[model samples]
Target: MKVSLFITCLTDLYAPTVGMAVVKTLEHFGCQVDFPADQTCCGQPAFNNGYPEHARTLAQRMIEVFKKADYIVTPSGSCCAMIRDHYPHLFADDEVHQPEALEFVGRTYEFIEFLTKILKVDLTPYRLPEPVDFTYHYTCHLRGLEMTGDPCIGLLRQIGNCRFVPLEKAEQCCGFGGTFATKYPDISGAIVRDKVQCGNRTRAQVMIVNDGGCAMNIGGAGHRYGSTFAVRHAAEIIATALEGGKDNARR
Candidate 1:
């Protein structure tokens, strides 16, 4: 499969290792992964901040870059949802772009959903060096994209002795709604604080989030309070399982 990596702006800048892991994991499953160098932000931040024109400009660049990709995969559920669910509306009035927009969104898949549902690659060959307890935070767009069942957990189950702990209100947002967190700091801060608190309550050593924004938000808060739990991106965990096992998975 010719998989094109739509490494989100967050991953490109903040968590490039997760993006690298995604490539390694996909290649391990026999996929030919391509990293389109010119790809930029997926336009979700601008679009969510009520700047559709700016967002459309950003979207046009991505549309041009990955149109020929056999599969457009990204570690971001938020971006996947934006391109898949919102891009059509963003271009609804433009007859020239709408059809192609639909086609592009159809080809886009969030990394976890692509790995679990679309690719269905077997993971029996990978396992953790030690059993680790993990709790999943359901990021917003994964649910919006109908990426239900927290597919990452199912993927984790394939790893040897990885424990899945139940988190209270797993579907709740971590309060990092792009610029929403910046515009409404108090509300966002409180939401993320409560979310980290909830994850702490689960007593899971590792807190897993599908979206980088959520992981950063929740993980940041956890670190500030010196919470015992460690936060990680799903791609990092999966890549660790494939590469080094549990010891290397620790951040």
Candidate 2:
């Protein structure tokens, strides 16, 4: 299976480790992974901000980059969703890129969804040494995008000896809606505060979010308040499990 990595812009900058772990994890599963340097942002930020023209420009660039890959896997659900669900609309009137846009969307998959659903790779060989307990924050774009039917809970369950504590109102947004956080800092902070409080109430050492934007907001707030909890992306946890990391790894 040949897979192309669509390293989202946020991951490329803020969390490059996530991109590395994704490549390592896929290769561990016996799949050949390629990184297309030509790839850029998936255009979600611009598109969501109502900049269709700008979004289309980036989307077209991305489409051409991975046009020949058998599968295009991305670590970020929100970006994958934007490409899979929104790119078609963005290019609907573009006679040159419409078909290419559809082709790209047809092959895109979120990391966990691709791992568990399409690849169906057995995770029993992966092992985690510590029994880190965490409450997961299911970002809205992931749910709204329908990337995974289970919002990553099922995939986490497959890891050996990892404890997943359920967050009250786990489906609630962490209030980091890309530019939404910047535009409405107070409201975003209030929402993240509530999310951190919920994670703390669960008594979990860490909170895991699928999207980097949400993780940054929630994790940043936790850091500012000196909250006992830390934040991690699902990919990092899974990668750690694969490597048999420490017995008390939180993030």
Candidate 3:
């Protein structure tokens, strides 16, 4: 299938490797992945900060940039949620853009959601060179997507030589609500501290978080709190497993 990569602002600026990992993983599953260089921020930060006009400007750019893509995939659940959940509402009053906005939402899928729901790609054939114990952090934006179960955890379980430890209060927010972390540092700090403590309790080698914002917030908190596990994106783990396994599937 043809897939276009929507490298979200956080992933583009702070975690480019996560974007690369996503491409690697998708290509391994026989997808023809391409990056649209014209794509920019999904206006999530501005939109969340109550700047609708500025956010709409950026959203319009995104709508036009990836209009031809058969599937728009991104590593960050937060960005996917922004496009899928908020874009329509942004253009609700504009009859000209509302239909385009809805089409954009329908074509976009967060990375894990694409893998488990659309591709249904079997990860059983992949194995890691060494066993890794990992737990998942369910980013708040994922709730916006209305996903039913823990698809990331399920996919992680499919990999050989990896242990899936249940994170205590797995669905709890990591306290990074885009500008929410900056505007309310004390509240955000307190919540992230609790999130790191929960991950530490898991005793896992790494905590898998698909959203860049949450990962940054949790990683910062983890550093201050001296968290036991490293923070990593799911795509990174999957890419590593695909590369290490004997049945390497990339084209």
Candidate 4:
């Protein structure tokens, strides 16, 4: 499949390694991946900050930028949720742009969902270099996308040497609701503190977060709270598993 990577602003600016992992994982499955340099923010920050006009402008540009893409993928669930769950509403009154917005939503997918759903990927052959006990935090926006099931956990189970560490309150938000974190630092801090504690309780080696913003918030708080686990992106973990599997097969 021809896939266009929508490297979200947070991923592009803060976690470029996650972007590389997404690309590597996709290519390992025979995908033709390309990056659209003109792509910009999906206007999520502006929309969340209550500036509809500015958000609409950015959404319009995003629609135009990836007009030719066969499939659009991003590592950040929140950014994908902004496009799929909210973009149509942003252009609902505009008859001219609403259809395009829907089309944009149809093609866009969060990284893990695309792998498990659209690609129907089977990672049963893969194994981590060593067993890893890891927990996952489902980002809040993922529920908005109707991904109520544990697709990510299901995929993680396929890695032979990895253990799925069930996180307490996995569905709870990590307190990184874009500007919500900044606008209410105390509330955000408290929420993330609880989240990090939950992860700590799992006693896992790493916490896998699919959204860059959530990873940043939880990772930082985990450090401050002296968490026992490291925070990681799902793509990075999957990439590591696939690399190990490839090396083992070569041997």
Candidate 5:
């Protein structure tokens, strides 16, 4: 498939390796991936904060940037959910742009969802060096957009010797709602603190997350709170598993 990588701004900065891994994994599956240089934020930051004008402006920019792609994929589920789930409402008032916005929605997908749902990737070749206990967190946006199976777990299960350490509150929000954390520090901190406690209770060596924002939020708090767990992106963990656990060497 001809794929265009969204490369969310947060991932581009805080987690470039995840973006790189996404590329490598897709290429391994014979996808022709293209990164459009002109892409910018998916306008989710502004949209979530009730700034429709600013959000709409960036939405238009993004639409124009990836207009020709056969399928648009991004490592961050939050960004994909923003464009796929929210952009239509951003342009609903304008009849002219609504059609284009809807068109964009049809071709957008979250990274793991694309692999499992669209590509039907054969995971028989992927394997881990040894079995390791791990847990995954689903960001708010991902759970909101994805109504079915856990794509992250589905992909992770493909790797031999890796076992999922399930979290009882796996669906709980990690308190990283973009500006929500900044606007309400106390509430955000408390919620994420509980999340860390829960993950640490699982005794999982690493916590896997799909959204860049969630990785930063939960991962950052995990460090601050001294949780006995390392935070990693799904792409990173998957790429490592595919490489026979080379990512473990870095840890």
Candidate 6:
């Protein structure tokens, strides 16, 4: 399968390794992955901030960038959700780009969803080390996307002796709604405080989530507040497995 990777803005800027990990994971499963350089921000920042015109500009550019791919895959569920679930609404009234926009959305899939549902790739061959206790923070966009949750949990379950710690309110937002964090710092900080508290209560060594924005918010705050737990993306965890990390060590 020809898979085009949409390295969302956050990954391209703050976490390029996540993009590399995505490529490695796909190739590990025998799929050919390509990165389209023309791809830019998925425009969720502006869209969520109530600037549809600017969001549409970037969204249209993204659509054109990956129009030729058989499948479009991304690591961030929030960005993927923007393209898949929200882009169509952005072009609903326009005939010129409506069909193209819809097609672009149709071809896009979150990484785990594509791997487990469409590709059905077996991950056991990656050789993950003895696992440690960790919790998963399912981002709002992922749950809202309505993709199957089993792929993530099922893959993690394959790790040797890895404990999947469930957060008290796993589905609740960490309150890092992109621009929301900047606009309302107090509320955002309060939300992240609770999220970190939840993870700390679990006594887990790390907190894993799929959204880059949330990871930055939670991880940054966790570091600032001297929270011992680390934050990482699911792809990073999978990369650790492939690299043979013991106790989920850094690769």
Best by TM-score: 4
Candidate 1: where are CA atoms >4 Å away? 244-251
TM-score of 3: 0.96
Reference-based lDDT, residue 155, model 6: 77
lDDT (tens digit, per residue) of candidate 6 on 1-251: 89999888888999988888889888877788998887889899899888999999999889888988999999999998888778989999999999999988889999888877788866555545655787888788886678646468777666654568888888779999988899899999999989888888888887887888998988988888777678877787777786663424333
Better of 1 and 3 by TM-score: 3
Off by over 4 Å in 2: 147-151, 245-251
List the pairs of residues colliding in candidate 6. none
For model 2, name the residue pairs that clash: 130-247
Write the number of the candidate with greater lDDT, choosing between 5 and 6. 5
The TM-score-based order of candidates, best leading, equals: 4, 3, 1, 5, 2, 6
Cα lDDT of model 4 overall?
Answer: 0.91
Residue pairs with colliding backbones in model 1 are: none
Candidate 6: worst-modelled 10 consecutive residues by lDDT: 242-251
Question: How well is each residue in 54-145 modelled by candidate 2, as lDDT tens digits?
Answer: 98888888988998899999988789888877888888888987987898898999898888778886665555776778778887777646
TM-score per candidate, chains pooled: 0.94, 0.92, 0.96, 0.97, 0.94, 0.92
- Lowest summed lDDT across 10 adjacent residues in model 2 is found at 242-251
Per-residue lDDT of candidate 4, residues 197-231 (tens digit): 99999999989999999999999998898999999
Q: lDDT tens digits, residues 60-145, model 3?
A: 99989999999999999889998888898899999998898899899999999999999998888888887899999988888889
Tell me which residue pairs clash in candidate 5. none
Q: Which is better, 2 or 4, measured by lDDT?
A: 4
Question: By the TM-score metric, which is better: model 1 or model 4?
Answer: 4
Give lDDT per model, in order.
Answer: 0.85, 0.82, 0.91, 0.91, 0.85, 0.83
